[model samples]
Target: MANSTTLSTGKTFAWGGGKSPFSVSYGKLMMWIFLLSDAFTFSSLLIAYGFIRYSYQAPIANTIIKPLQHVGENFVEEMKKAGLFVQDHWPAPELVFNHFPFIHGMHLPLFFVSLMTFILIFSSVTMVLAVEAGHRMKKDEVANYMLLTIIGGAAFLGCQAWEWATFIHEGARLDYNPFGPRSFAALFFIVTGFHGFHVFSGVVLNVIIYLNVLAGTYEDRGHYEMVEKVGLYWHFVDLVWVFVFTFFYLI
Candidate 1:
């Protein structure tokens, strides 16, 4: 198996810093710093969400991205009280999210969003596997997993595009709209959409890495730690979604 690390050449090797002066690489360090900045951007958005909710006196989780299915016995009752649906007081997320354009009939909740999250998380797994394969010098296996990761990324983007379409058409406005049903609509879109943009950008980055893998550029260079770095970025995007899912949809 190939070594996990690519050593520095000449003088820098002699210096013998424990981590080899950023064992990851200058580009990777820059990527991490950029990711930190992106983290702050999300912080500002989530904080703004808190401020707006405080202003709206909104029902909190009473509505928005309802659960895809019932959990316990009374989950339906609790969901109904959230204001998203009207009926035998069954629940809303299922109807609101699942039904989509078919409000007259019952369906499921946040189906598309759930699917997107699944794709992203799956991509993270594939990316980690790719890095593992790289460590073993299984170039073909690494490329396969990396390709799958790229496909997962594409699937995620497709889901996000569809989500934006649904949101924009939902009749809510910056002034007032249907799903904003309160301030929640605009805030949900802004927050989720911002994250989706990051996902799209991440997909682009993945494509670049995938191409490099296929071209054998990284192999000849004698190191694949960049895959590990990119994997970090991919996982961060997925982690942010977890918070978004809980706060925006499930609460």
Candidate 2:
């Protein structure tokens, strides 16, 4: 027998076993738990990065190069000479991440990364649209939005790969960092790499869900809860990137 109580309005409320007080499905609840754990991990990494970054001297001011200004191949050396890239001082993110694809030798601080962030946030929007379509049982709409979301995720990943390659070409390795401190490169790789992996996983999950949608799996199941579940994961990935961008690039 379940317990029952009377409210002030004389309505009876039953306490049933197997009911979620939060009004979410079990799967959704579990996903929330997993996201919470993942958030803690990212937070710890960012906190450590912040501690180490501030422990060093502040980044030197950049007065020589303006946006779109031409720079020679010895950009790193020039920055070093300018006292902007030193072991004791944290490297300015703008100086370190100024390169853009097909627009080399020009100083464009944070441009590419900002574009990447936009792509990710746009993907999250598409995911939301897909979930909304799912609620309406609009199979075609859901499929289209899912496809767009996947494309956005893939584009962001490509941008990240390019950024990583450029960094490595500039002599930024896990053990060696020409930027400022070795820990800078290492932490960058660890934190961004971890987040990138999560994005990749989310993309893969999105693909699977997309395929299932095309196959009428959700329609056959009589609900689109799967899409909503995967949407939860995808949104979590996008939210994590916001923090990563803020911590690594902004502050």
- Candidate 2: stretches off by over 4 Å: 1-15
Q: List the residue pairs that clash in candidate 2.
A: none
lDDT of 2 at 139: 98
lDDT per residue as tens, model 2, 108-192: 9999999999999999999999999999999999999999999999999999999999999999999999988889999999999
Q: Write the per-residue lDDT of candidate 1 for residues 1-251, one digit (tens) a residue.
A: 13234356423342354453555577788888988998898888888876665554334345344344334433334444555433212222334344333332333567666777788888899999999998987778888998899899888877767666765564445555443245556776788888888788888888888889889988998888778888888888998888787766664
- Scored by CA lDDT, what does every candidate get? 0.69, 0.92
Best model number under lDDT: 2
Query: What is the clash tally of candidate 2?
Result: 0
lDDT at position 153, candidate 1: 83
Q: Relative to the unseen true structure, what is the C-alpha lDDT of residue 41 in candidate 2, on a scale of 0 to 100? A: 93
TM-scores for candidates 1 onward, in order: 0.73, 0.94
